[model samples]
Target: MSDLNARVVIIGAGHAGGTLAALLRQYGHTGPITMVGDEPIAPYQRPPLSKAWLKGEADADSLALKPLEFYAGANIDFRPSVKAVKLERSARRVHLSDGSELGYDFLVIATGARAIALPIPGADLQGVLSLRTAADAEALKAQVGPGKKLAVVGGGYIGLEVAASGRALGAEVVVLEREARLLARVACETLSTFFRDVHEQHGVTFELGASVTGFEGANGHITGVSLADGRIVPCDAAVVGVGVIPNDELAVDSGLETARGVVVDLEARTADPHVFAIGDVAHRPMPIYGRMFRMESVPNALEQAKQAACAITGRPAPAGEVPWQWSDQYDLKLQIAGYAFDVDEIVVRGDPKSGKFAVFHLKGDQLQSVEAINAPPEFMMGRQLIGNRKALDKAKLADPTVSMKEVTA
Candidate 1:
């Protein structure tokens, strides 16, 4: 098939799928492009759902990835509120829930993920929710405001972000974390402690090492959460932000290789060559780390979108991006670069008490990762350093007086 004329069918219409469509066109692909999305509306930004959108700082239109008219103007067939039910690999066709079928030379799966529902009693209650989409944000927003109490389950970034937003909205907020410390799964203890203190300063309470037995409800609405220790934390509503499960069922049913997520090569091409998977649904290779991970972040999605688009359009592969992510809580902006693994030494640049510092995780002289709190320069420099894979002076790195340029030299 001619590269430019090959038909592309993208499933999931999310950050990765949406961007692939745009990148395909940008790279001069003139093939028929059709995008299938399960959401009722066009693809939109999800990062703000738990923060700005919940706090009324962002609107639906503002959150949209593109103006609604951009799809038709670009001559892209955008299908909304449609689910892809079955994949017929032999026929190279996709069966949709709407009783329609799409034939394609190439298929991209970007089904993303859904919030994992807390499998506990009262989880199905009206006021118990999880934020993964604009719809979820809207529902949670209505329930949080003055005179309301919001109980946030989990101590990860999402839960803490919601807690910050709830506090901003004048709701009494309490966080329940099964772990003794917050962000135990994703961050170092130093960073976790810093965030916990920040949230506490914002009038949010914490129930650490607290195992939730279930939730308490009255009239089919959550009224409180019951802890394993016979403690009942009263609240009018609750949000479970444990994590998410990737939507890889369609790929699995289609006989695709999947390990937690759809397995793919560095180019995001599945074993079936004709199919590709990106975003949260892709169990892709992290060449820099020499490992495979299913990264759930915009940067990872955008990188894979470019990878797929370039591979399809016969363009040179784009440079690998340094793994990164960010979080905004109140006035604090936390930027994390690279992964924290097998670290030998940690250098703290500046004081955490000042609320503006960077924690550098190093193995010998090589940088592994850096977590910067309200420190943009440190984040950028650290990201570049990690990508460069160069050794640096530890003493100089920890000295705030030394310029980052000099530290690298």
Candidate 2:
């Protein structure tokens, strides 16, 4: 029995699993590390699928998170196109779709997430698509060009980015959101308003407060979108950017505690001692927020995977700083530094009319988070402010009268 090559099996080769594999090597982990994923291609970024990649500015190679040679050089048994069908927790093994079973000393479930399907009539039509993978982006790109009519379902960051990309290609774009306001799920009103103006300035039409109930298609290609209010919109194609659900079926079947996703502690360890979970699949708590939630961001995935790998490989738990998410919409770069939901007040710093502003969401005198649009200094300063539990005077932060560095000084 050679304990020297102790097996470590990691499911899903997304940002979380990929980072865990690389971090294990960095920590001098000399063991058999196997990375498995259902996707045929190597781990690439989902962020660009809605933005630059769709506009033909970024190539597939540019979107690759890590090169193929890097995985080989690090001695990782990378297994793509292999889906983990079942988890045998008691046996310390995972059953694959190909009738093969692999054992692990430490199992990491980074199965990530999948796009939530639109329950509309023509949701499965050929022209109807969901933006989640590289294949989705490539297909959508081919349909976008000059004089095309495109309808984007959902007004979240993903939908907005796609709208911006399609408009850039000289396509007439329309966004359909069920909510009264855009980005209602994640962002505050102040940030959403800023984005609304950005999209409008680019000639992107807003069909806000509208929900898609069905689609008008003849031969599996979407011709128009049918709204819940019986309004029919003529469009060439449709892109669904609703939301995502965590892939937690295997973890839940294995008797691991799961609320929204796999429940993990600060160290990314699940209820089971030998098994751990990370990425968008893990519903971990934030010491700042005092609650547990699944974060569907690349940053969250990498940070949690790094922490989980450290804990499983006998290294100390590297405490995460702050949970952050970023979005690239046209010329503006939206960066959220911390979680700020149900805030008592919203303070705007700088001129949003100029397309450069930051929203400081506050609960009384305490700062909750900063949603910055083209305001890097505020995002950077607000990040430190969130971590240190420091508060800035609302007036000073609002006025472009002072530099952000002065607050730290």
Candidate 3:
């Protein structure tokens, strides 16, 4: 492809899109590159939006992907607040909401995912909030007033983060979930129990095994949540973070195959040769885990972008480490390093009672992954172990007395 003739257009100014822009420039692809963002601000760290950022402990300045000058200097166009409506793939163009079309030789759909909305009545009330964007953080933060009652409508990471933040702000916080346990979507009962205790210690309350069927409002502002079990969880403000739906509408409408997320090959390329998908919208295959998943973490977004950039630039790329994810709640740092779905055995190292341990998951004798709480060293080594297919003795792995370094060796 001729340098000037080949223009790359990426939808979504997020970690995957922004990092792709930088990678393309670093690899000497001197063609025109433009990043379209639906949000007014450029790409920022999303993990913080649920944790320290919500408590006002962190500022927006530290969440940037690249400085304003960095984008301009690299010859990449940054178009903020642009809504991409339609994909004219046959024309190799994208139709924007502003009645303008942009052409591209190669296109990347990194639109990420949107918060799953509350489906019941009174969902659109004024006091109800969802935390997914910068505007949402600012709005939710403003609502977290002193001595106010905060109701978290989901027990997921986002909901817990908001509950923690609300509790820190001296507001009475309660987490309501339809499931019997918290974080059940991704974690086991043991992990969920650990979190329950941690949150309760921070003055957060949880309504487990309960479902909110509807919201109660007064004058178009939410005031309470109606449970399926015939109870009302009353509050001044409600934060809904049930889950996310992948923003694969563009890919789907553009005739690209999408399942769970945009189904892509190991190279992050969609079935369409001219188009690719990454970040939260990509359901890429993992060779190690032998499964397809869409990971929503900073490392995943960056790694996926790097793989996509390599494929476009004619470089060989490995999937790298097995897919891992993490979340921050209060002072506890939960790091997951592998898939636990098929693991036949789980070994607990360190001490769960001590609130610092690593749950070693293995399929027979082969080490699969490790979920650690406040065990950064074990998490780091586990990442390398899963990537390298490191094996360990089952007996030693479960014994906290044996150093993990020695057991792996």
RMSD of each: 1.0, 2.1, 1.7
Query: Number of the top candidate by lDDT?
Result: 1
Error of 3 at 405 (Å): 2.2
Flag regions of model 3 displaced more than 4 Å.
1-5
Residue 18 of model 3 has an lDDT of 90
Clashing pairs in 3: none
Pitting candidate 1 against candidate 2, the one with the higher lDDT is: 1
- The candidates, ranked best first by lDDT, are 1, 2, 3
What overall lDDT, based on C-alpha atoms, would model 2 receive against the true structure? 0.86
Which portions of model 2 miss their true places by more than 4 Å? Answer: 1-5, 405-409
Tens digit per residue, CA lDDT, model 1, 137-196:
999999999999999999999999999999999999999999999999999888999998
Residue range 1-409, candidate 3, lDDT tens digits: 1243368999999889999989988866778998999988878887788677778877667888887778898888999999789998889999998788899988999999999997899889887899988788888888886878899988987788788888878889999987899989877777888888999988888898888888899988878989998999888889999899999999989889999799998878898888989999998988788888887877778888888787777666845756778877777889998777587877887877798998878887777878899999788877777777777777877777877777763
Candidate lDDT values, in order: 0.93, 0.86, 0.84
Number of backbone-clashing residue pairs for each candidate, in the order shown: 0, 0, 0
Local accuracy of candidate 2 as per-residue lDDT tens digits, 246-350: 999999888899997999998888878778899999999888867788888988998898788777677777866788889987778989998885588888888
